[model samples]
Target: MVAVRDYKTALEYVQTFEEKDGLSAEQLMDSSVRGGLTYNDFLILPGKIEYPSSTVTLTTKLTRNITLNAPLVSSPMDTVTESEMAIHMALLGGIGIIHHNCSPEDQAEMVKKVKTYENGFINSPFVIGPNTTVAEARGLKEELGFSGYPVTETGDLSGKLLGLITSRDIQFVEDDTLLVSQLMSKNPVTAKHGITLLEGNEILKETKKGKLLIVDDEGKLISMLSRADLMKNQNYPLASKSATTKQLLCGAAIGTIEADKYRLQLLVEAGLDVVVIDSSQGNSIYQLDMIKHIKENYPKLEIIAGNVVTREQAASLIAAGADALRIGMGSGSICITQEVMACGRPQGTAVYQVSKFANEFGVPTMADGGVQNIGHIVKAIALGASTVMMGGMLAGTTEAPGEYFFRDGQRLKMYRGMGSIDAMKKTDKKANASTSRYFSESDKVLVAQGVSGSVVDKGSIKKFLPYLYNGLQHSCQDIGVISTAILRQEVDNGNVRFEFRTASAQLEGGINNLHSYEKRLHD
Candidate 1:
């Protein structure tokens, strides 16, 4: 029983001098048992909002040299990413890593396809000689999946332009041996090189022709345009492209084996923009040697190394001249590396520690795994990762490299890890055991680090990615930051606070009372 004035003074003093309500990222992490934590184990404390969500910017770096409008990346898993997925990811302001589970030639061709998908001018259009048979033209169409071919006198791109052959020219012709010259449209509409696509499109509309050939001053065919492509004009405003060629930027994955060097040569020739050295444990001597060798030989190429969790592993790769670091180990949803090998750190702790270490050296870091939702992505970035590399999150999209099938009343796409037994057993001769991504040990003993699974179809990435980007923007607004860079700065300065969630708190935070509910990810 104390006096009222004394009690009031004590209450005021306690209120004024109490410890800060929330923990800084470092403090929260240090308090964890052995510094181990996962994404869902903690929550970011909301801050006072000074701006609207729409005004928040999400731009961030993907590598030391490459910047992305959106800080998302698709994983380099065979069942997840390919040319289609890469193209869409780039268009949506992110980048995709093409898997190396196929032959070098096949992978190189995929890279070429992405680079040549859309261009201001077609520098290398298909050409046929005057003597080329109608059947041969049809075969070319079937193989290359294009119906229009420019007819040149010398059957080469440098030859003088003669005519153009289209599917209409051979629709009624039954003779397979008929020469293209006999049926092609002679003196077809032509546009000189250096004409804008708009000008070419106008000329095409006025001529009402299916094909428009762009020729040099000497009348040699240099490029071609199609009315179909113009009508279906797809514009990727956020697309990443080469500064010189204006071709789309693409990345591919490779192992540290000797054959990978030759494969990398082919990929570089195909105009690969970046290479991800695929390995579960990237601190190995083999990976370090490969990183050094590639940096010495291809000095201009950018290399992203690691699937490492600790600061030492990151230091080794960064010292070896890695342009970017991929941080994570055994934290992916489908991963079993920790259980099987009894190694690897929890994803949240790994990302925070490795990114903090790598940022000091001016190298960007990617949160490589354990991104199950948009909240996870926000947490990854808030932890100092420059970008979040997703696997299962992007695996079920329509652009992903797989067909959908129905099972248990749900449409799902196949998703598997590179080290899964099913993936290791794939019959691609070029993808031998040495290139079995996560497992580079003895070929005879199959030690799996992941599993084979399927994910529910999430529709197209066009919708899904926009939802994710908007979610991130809203998150930044809630965090009272106006951009990703600002968020990172605040996090590093300890201005951004966080709190660990107890088991009961997590349960209360989720929708627990509902007996049944239909979940909607986007509004």
Candidate 2:
């Protein structure tokens, strides 16, 4: 069975004039590329990792403080951007733009979820004097949800940090009465205040530890680094840079009719980055008035206005001091604003128009819907969208809150639309054109459409994020763009080509007529 020639030579020998003249891609339908089908004839997209390698900075400068890793964002939908999802996204280095389809308190809980998942705050981390007991450390971890403690010489950390104690370091002790000093990690790796993050990473990697202690000039314990803190913005993992500001950035969705000031203030205190003044019909006096009020009072807080579909609407929000814009008009899978009332633009075109104008004023635009997969993400980025807001796709995940229940022999989460019937009380939340107005006075409960519902399987965002990250990396690798900025540049510079496709061709190729290999390894 040994071959006399290599693959290239063997292929040349196997080629027959009959095969070339008589066959097409359609004829082979198996292993060949078939008739003029080039990689350019179809679009391969980027996921989260394949960022442009040209060193174009992608820092989401918010409130002069917090910076995110990837500019890519998950949409704030009822079933998508929840507490679990937010924390995982943050862990994976992207931001989970939490949805606000629920009550104000619930939304606040979502914020707390991200900050609390794993953190190193100025206050309230596990702290203990050098002479504490291992039993005490174990108790602290079990009860308070903190797994380890920073050991300082004085209770106030005024002296040098003596060492550190973790549950694993203490678990095998013969005596529960053993002192923490007996088991503590002594003279643990420490970082000076001005050290680079890259240097910090190396120290952590060398020591094989979760965090490092930050010390002042005199070796006074200044702060602690949580393992979670060290892992952020995975896309553009930083070597190191000191954050001059302490502000945390978050995005919120507010109603145009009754966005409460008290709630707004609470969000500002909770580290809200931008306020998305959400509305079905955003070009009205009601939304404009709300924008004016927010700008007047919370002058320092960044406000992003939207659901706007045109240049004029985008213009109005921009003029009202919008820090960013959300562009889409009835593109949502569950939205019926356009169908029932006959208003709104095609989302693709809407993104183009709004993003074009919004970019002119330095306000970033988020393409809000119609993102069924990673391709939509790439397309939105190419069309000048600063980011994408996904809902249905990201839903049913751990960060997306829900209890799993049996449905059609599978576990799933409740995934539904906002303007959906569940969102509408059969009466009040119901849409009435008399209640619905497009460019004028209107009604129809205007929302009354089919109460269609779908169920999705519940899972954690951790697994899902890696899929996106790898997918984006492979996409960029194929296109020869190492970064998102570069990919966009290639697309804009005509270095990219787009090809529309149908399901048949996509599925027809690859190993066919193979055995089913019916076997269950795990199940």
Candidate 3:
């Protein structure tokens, strides 16, 4: 007997009455791509899928002798990536990039925090005194790049809080001698340290402030709470952006001989997967010697050297004991090196040219900066990045630094360029100022490229990563491939098709009445 049914009834019969027991789940996979996928894949966010799982190893191979579970890497943008976030990412199976925009000490502290996270014992924060002058507060914010301080009644947390200070309170205050009480918001709202994050958040909402100073039952400051902390706790705004525990390859920058020694020891103890010989120019003898030193000492360590734009510069570093090369000049949103210093390469040509040569040696390369979205990530991977290094794109998410702000019915995170003036003051080795020392150096406060704060809170990478993965998988599925490696092979084999046309062609296909969730349309 032959049976027939309409679309709705057929779907029901397949889901309910169809005989699925004896058949292997694999057989039905292709039959139900729609049902197997989440809404994210269905929407088809843009990205590339270079190879299929059945063909290539998704488990990325590191330079010297390391391996990673995930192919993902976090950007080193100051606003988006930091030590805490880096440690969390490593714990979860990815690497965290430390931005170069900050001072070596502050950046080192960020790295130290990542290291401290491993021991599980942490140095909690303490508040500066209320008597701390506005001039001092300004200096502190400038030096640390964060303003989560409250004024202590007795000059520190042992006493009560007479006022609250934030980056905003002293941002424009001209009276350097003015009492912090005059500058800081008075008797600001706070939360008891013992209170749950939920309870504290409720109190914070009622007060409408950027942070809630956590105190003991006796009202002594214990810790500070910002919207970033709250969201991370709740795994907001995206579960993918949540902090994870992945033992990851982490790299740091060191200029001086002493800094390099300490950095080297830290890398070894941390079981670092890769060490980047960070420099403004990759061809410098300093980097060459440093790379050689690291390889000779930690002969087992993998080294990625250079910020090179050409194969000529890249070759020298590669010959000087570099395992992989970092290619980019100044294509970063916050970087003005190409513009200011007039030395660098256009990112596309740089990747294409350097990757071409590096691939011959079987030594992989990483594309640093110049990535904005999933598509860019795909392109970089296709162009020869074992993995992509992002900076600004990863910033502003929950996993990134800073507190989230709610204003004008929208949520946003603080984002800045590494080369920006504010970042320079906080991380420059020359700053030689403590969080307490440079409480007022505004001339260096050049507020460069990102003053408009052009960043949105995409929740966290915990959620965002899944979105990217599923989206990429769907891209492969649609293109008739099974995994990322296969996609790359196909392109290499000339089986993957490429077409270039005017942008209008994008609208030429697809259903006009495809209807979005929020709106219904009819033909």
Candidate 4:
């Protein structure tokens, strides 16, 4: 037996030695006590930095083949993303998935509009026959918000370019039944089909013409150039576009029903870049069969599968040839899946686990929900997420689908989940009973996995997204990483560390004991 003094000396040695080690990402997550971990539960440790935040790069892949200058994606919810939102997202270096709650024809047209918005030339400009009435032209102008129509002998694009019609020609017309030919500008300025955009702009400026039709030698319309487009000179350096056609990249969502297959054909014909198999639970036989069918039929079209939270679910989708995995289940601000079904993991844990597993197979993963702030975005990227998909974060902006209203002196926009009762009711009455947006259609009574709500106005994506992009760069600078790829690598190698925040520490971190405060995102 050792002496009592020797035991005391050993105890003293243990007490004197201290451990200052930080927790790895995995350690911080796996050490969660009883409850699941969330983005707010922990904080990333600051690292050594030698460069400015402006030098940081945020480029990351949105899919196995598609890269985004910013690792951001707008959600496919109807109230969140549509043609306008999708176009703006692409312009800002992210992508948006057009929601499929509308008719297939309407959805396809939306996709077409995005692809047609920015092009070297408008290959298919809106055309009206010489017989089109002034009433019809006015209706077109009212509906499409443009009055410049190319008047062809026949209504078809391949017909002879008779002349051009502009607001100037129709503004003074009092007769509603008068044909467009009577009011059209005869012998309008024309450019040869092979003329470059610069040359076409020069002709427009010289002739003071609002519309410049590019025609073949036979005088058939080949393309058209707009004076407005030239004057705007909008340059989206990071716009997502196809390498071959240079059309803006667009995606559409589809369910696992038989009708969706027909819808997919229409979307693909409209130059859809990707298809998301939209479902709350993605491991169903319906989803698996649909994924296989799409991969077999449209091999080039990338498929983003699932709202899965577990590694096993991700593995199944990955084996089914999913190009990217959407991680998060009922983690949205409007989602109540966890509360109702008693299922679904926290968003942070789900993102980390699914992304880590998907990365092994060369498949990227997106954090689908629960992105309340910029810090949450940085945390998701550090956890190996290639892109973060936002619904609520982007919902209240100017580009969002719904109109803003004053609610108790606050300007707000309507934002409802795809699974909410309001969305289902507005979608289709008959289909609401059959379709399952949130996996609750099998129940006798429809139980909503999400709620209808409103978010405060956040101005426009033009200002908000840049703020997010800049804030993310600052976060990367703080982590001592210059790019999302490097950040993920450091996280994988246990170089990027984290620490769990206790209740007291969390209180200390926030603005506690304050009577009031004003929060402004950016100057």
Candidate 5:
């Protein structure tokens, strides 16, 4: 025979308890019995969940001027980011920083590719000459991964469109010597170039064609719209785009040397939106000078500076007009800088300290390395990182540079740190990314701070990124935070709580005493 308490009585009783379950961010980060802390050293306490996980907002700032729908950034590693990776990342609501491990012309071309990328429109569609053989068109289909090509007299965009060719037109043709002009469809449906995307969609639906060519008054093709692109647009509604051009945002890394100034001019001409002053140690006079120079010369380009891990380093870059700070040193999966140099801070402490300071200036901070999973990304944001930069995490994806190789019956791809000896030796001093970052291009002997390795194939980023986004959204829901901005605000006000985990507590939090297990992150 027990009596249940009324709702008012239960509420009052719960309110009377003054002690909380966990520590505040100030209490957790300020208490330094140990030297430094990492993401595994703590956990965030769960709060009341009143909304659905699908409703959580993951939007955050990439720099002082750039806001993204997602807080994920691909690192500026040669194997991690190129034009392909940059285009897809911007489409998925994050941004990629193109690496400068190639010639200036090549890097600028990559930047141009990203700048010209449109979601539903294929600008500069591939064209073929009317005399092109069936065998050559098949070879092109295999190489370009697409089947349709517009036939032109000059085999380029400058020529007038004569006809169109598709896979279905030649699938059953037995003669390999047949010319495209013999099998092409003449007078394909088309619209004027000035038509809106909605009108283009209507024309495509009404005509029931796989592609709709937009042409000028002279009948020269301006662009092509594909049904596949339309599907992609519907799938990714939160795509990150420029407010003016509606083009995908693009960023590229540049060295701090005087020669880089000329390289940067070419990139600026290619429509680079942001420039990351790539450096291993960003507090040097060289980096500060470069920051100020870029600020004075390229006044409109947003700058993200540093591979810094301390408040002092962050302050110098921010004062020199860095719109954003890249935190973490020697914390990458492939990096051995902490072991060889012994001068870097632990990632969790570094992010918390620098982000806490940068927030005062309204400057955002990017936690640059050592993030292995969604939980690590959540912890980084909880500690105050505005975004997380990943290299290895994104290296093996389909969009990343490099072809897949098989070993031991498992698919793998190359993954390396910028400090690796292999990376430094891959290129000469003219355009080498690793040697320039290490400031040892002139040194007779090169020391390695990172290793070259391979990661298991992570498949296409199209499937992978949505998985990460959904996982992050659910994590935020479990924490009772609907948005990253509010989460940080609650942390500052001492409402969101944290708890330092002991070594045994960390072990207990994971699977224990398991003989065998299979972990599947996504389908």
Candidate 6:
């Protein structure tokens, strides 16, 4: 019998040029002496495009142990990430870190929600009691954005199975007080709780039902599988999931304080796949001790430590067993850390220096902050970061935590940095995420390192992420690299080129001469 290799393994190694058109990554970093370069300070030189953008692969590692189909991560900000954002981020081939600005129990609940969110099944689905009125069900439908719900004895997953309620039952009910038990479909088909997704799909197809409830031997509800979710599984081919559990990977942020030890324990129990040791400056002893403690206790958990901008900081975290490093300081769009503290390297330079050093220790780095568009993402990869952590770029999306409001006839959502006063004030005083991040919780006075603002509404992650993914693919294709791995290799080999953009060149590259125009990214 003949053996065949997978398509990824069979892919041919593309050629690279010896005589490059512009400065190499190393040269660019070295030449940036007076002040480090930002994304806008330089531009990547395009390579020969030989294949369609759709053919470009973007699989990369977020850490030494965790790999993602896409090199994207949502920042752990109060207004940017929550259970909703984390779930969608994982389903779209990336991960979101749940912010720790809230109570530990609340944060843990958010992590649990992401872990329990199955691709074809709702593990901890919304449930209603038999006595629930038609009006209440309609209100729930509007809140949850779903029409069908499993009806249980006690209105929750812990109760015994009763029946199922759907939009069809309450659509035209004249009486607002009509009970769910009266209109729910009786004797619904269900399977044992431990059935595989394939088996559930088969049962749903055979029974011609829209949902398949999983229950225990005593007829207690365990989960609900939906046909819509099955369709979504087919649609999202690049979803990031764990191989062993077949669940979407989830992450959460935690401070480096003594109290956070308990927070980490709760998060770990909730099936957290990764933990980011969130800090504005990550080189202190607190973070080092926290990293060592976590490594010793939870050997299986991957840790991404830092908001560091130097090689020295990366070395310390890597020594303390960090699997990945977050490289950026004072570079976030809403952050003013450099101005307030007068201590931070330029983002482009910071990413290059730390990522290069971390690579020596077999550690990946996340370029956090200052990512404005798809081009910036490509630039970070070229500079050696394996993934990019987005804050302002991803804020204002439908999934991001916050309600959208109209301002000046434009829809907008709140976006605030963790170090912003508003965010600090919103956090629990005993467990303030902002003060802990800046290592100033014990200070007599509170200081702000970031600002609060709002961003134009950017619709849903379902629509927004695909645009980013395709844009990244097209960018890699233009750079003549078929995969993210090769993109880094080409940059290292000086095959991919870069050039410093003058101020005039920056203006020239944009819509300079256009009188006025509406910029639409995706429909």
Task: Report the C-alpha displacement of residue 428, candidate 3, in angstroms.
Answer: 6.9
Q: Name the better of 1 and 3 by TM-score.
A: 1
Regions more than 4 Å wrong, model 1: 1-21, 31-34, 50-52, 133-143, 163-217, 224-234, 428-436, 439-441
Candidate 3 lDDT at 326 equals 80
Best by lDDT: 6
How many clashes in candidate 2?
Answer: 38
Q: Model 4 compared with the native: what TM-score? A: 0.86
lDDT of each: 0.86, 0.60, 0.59, 0.86, 0.89, 0.90
The Cα RMSD in angstroms, rounded to one decimal, for candidate 1 relative to the true structure is 4.4
- Provide the global lDDT of candidate 2 against the true structure: 0.60
Q: Write the per-residue lDDT of candidate 1 for residues 1-523, one digit (tens) a residue.
A: 9645666577567668445459888887883453588998999999889988988888888889988889988998888889999888887878889888888898899988887776545667878899999899989989998888888989999999999888999989999999999999998999888888779889988999878899989999988877765554455566666666556678999988888899999999988999999998999998998998888889988999998999999999999999999998888888898999999999999999999899999999999989988899999999989999999999999999989999999999999877787778775452553234665445656777789999999999989999999999999898889999999999888888899998898898888888899999985
Pairs that collide, model 6: none
lDDT of 5 at 80: 98
- TM-score of each candidate structure, all chains considered together: 0.87, 0.67, 0.56, 0.86, 0.85, 0.84
Runs off by more than 4 Å, candidate 3: 1-57, 100-249, 255-258, 266-271, 431-452, 501-523
Q: Which of 2 and 5 is ahead in lDDT?
A: 5
- Residues 1-523 of candidate 3 have per-residue lDDT tens digits of 7766777787567668534322221222122332221111112123344555333334454454545544566755557677766865665555676654444556666665565443211114446785788777777778866676777777766777666877787678778998777777877777655665557667666777767777677777666656645444354221112112221236554442434565557556644445666554678766777877787788876777777878899889878878888888777766676776667776755775687678778777778868766666665555556666767766776878788888788898877655555555564453322111112223444423322255766776666665555554555565556655655555455455443222354455334555554322111
Task: List the candidates ranked by TM-score, beginning with the highest.
Answer: 1, 4, 5, 6, 2, 3
User: 3 or 4: which has the higher TM-score?
Assistant: 4
Report the candidate with higher lDDT, 2 versus 4.
Answer: 4
Model 5, 356-444: lDDT tens per residue? Answer: 99999999999998899999999999999999998988999999999899999999999998889888988756348888888877778
